[model samples]
Target: MFAAWWKLGFDTTLLAFEAQSVIALRMAKLAAGGTAAQAEAQRMVSEKVLAAGEAAMQLATGASHGAVVAGYRRKVRANHRRLSRGAKAI
Candidate 1:
């Protein structure tokens, strides 16, 4: 009976350790994935900002596509207003 109890206790401890290790590994993977996703999102936002700036410059120089650029600028302004309102609410 004593040997059986000791064996059971050891087995429980080992199982607990394995569970903790698995949880730790999963958390690490999630953190890494989150960092990668954040970087990608930032890169995409930068590209969008650069494109918008180029469009604005073209509009300022009275480019032939003024109508299309004006529409895009309007859309961008609407999005900014929506985002600002949401941020203020938060």
Candidate 2:
């Protein structure tokens, strides 16, 4: 009876060890794949953010230029009006 118990115990231990090894290998594979995917996702997001920032900067620059042009045009019109009134008085 004792011998049978020992044999059974040994077999169970061996099977358990094999199962643990397989589980560890699978976990390693999953972790590696997850890490690679995470890196790729981060890189893509960063690229998208960079692109958005560049577009926003371009839009802001265009708006500022337009505002300056409009202001300059208003100033020129005012100057012309003043000169015309002065000429009429003279």
Considering every candidate listed, which one attains the maximal TM-score?
A: 1
Tell me the tens digit of each residue's lDDT in model 1 across 1-90.
787667656655654565455445434444556664466457547856977787777778887453434445454455445444534443
For model 2, the stretches where C-alpha displacement exceeds 4 angstroms are: 34-90
Q: For every model shown, what is its TM-score relative to the native structure?
A: 0.34, 0.34
Q: Over the stretch 4-88, how does candidate 2's per-residue lDDT look in tens digits?
A: 6676566556545654554454344435566644664565467547645755675677754334334434433443454345345
Error of 1 at 59 (Å): 75
lDDT accuracy of residue 72 in candidate 2: 36
